[model samples]
Target: MTVDAVEEPFRTQLTVRLRQGDTLLGVPLPGPCTFTSGNGIDILWMGPDEYLVLGLELSRESSDLEAELSRESSVLAVVDVSAQRNVYRLTGVHAADVLAHGCAIDLEVAPVGTCVQTLLARTGIVLMVREDGFTVLVRQSFSDYFRAWLADASLEYVS
Candidate 1:
């Protein structure tokens, strides 16, 4: 199995109540329980009125997004969490099985573009289902252990 810590394009997380006709950086906010992408930016629906934005970490664009969303409401919040987590790209024929060892989520039935917040080895993580693999996002503090666990869990399949 191949498990590598790879750099993501960029991420901007936000918490706010998005309403009809609301747009962030000209991209229409994805409604509840869905995801939307525009211009290479993907917005993951994490919770009601909550989304995690992924794209290139362009400083100027970041500023523009923030400035525009700030007016959404007084409770609207745009936070840059690009550095808060370590993302591991786990790929191989056995990668999904390896994740199932710890994750209770049924990846076998999940769509390719789905993202689920779940636990792996008792650590909170975000698992993004890809066509051939998964993108696992864990907090920086837990990255080392998470990565090690992945290595051990997939040894049988890899070897």
Candidate 2:
């Protein structure tokens, strides 16, 4: 199993627009090029004042999460974009190399907890560096193509 790519669907995904230094939501908004994980959720910094909140718990409903986040006065907007993207877990030692085949970012120096929004295989994606592996978030429309590309890119390392 050289870079296993498994789709993780139905996870709660919220696009949050908040002020840069607001900590009212309890979840720390990570800075550029980083993510903060805790309480079964990961907050990925998408832009200077925007973040993608991913609920690590697969069973959680996006509506419930969205409602909860919406109550925060500091949050400018809480959009439930759960269905807009599909989560893919890419594991194993060759995972980074496989991603590098299409991504321009140098993954070698990206420490765990690093997250960045970029193009992978020409598909826009949000990649989070994790201890076990890497978590890839790709738009649903491009999921199939990205999956095929990942498989093909990792073919040489399967043996």
Q: By TM-score, how accurate is candidate 1?
A: 0.77
Q: Please identify model 2 stretches exceeding 4 Å from their true place.
A: none
Instruction: Please write out the lDDT profile of model 1 over residues 1-159, one tens digit for every residue.
Output: 243335455455444445434566566776554466686566677887677776645633665666666666533567777677776677777777888889899888887778777899999987777666777778889988887887788777865
Q: Which candidate should be chosen as best, given lDDT against the real structure?
A: 2
Q: Kindly report which residue pairs in candidate 1 clash with one another.
A: none
lDDT by residue (1-159, candidate 2, tens digit) is 766888876788889998545553587778889999776778888888888888876645777778877888778898888889999898898998999999998999999999988999889999999999999999999988987898789999998
**Model 2 TM-score relative to the real fold:** 0.92
CA shift at 61, candidate 2, in angstroms? Answer: 1.7
Model 1: how far residue 43 lies from native, Å: 0.7
**Candidate 1 RMSD to the real structure:** 3.2
Count of backbone collisions in candidate 2: 0
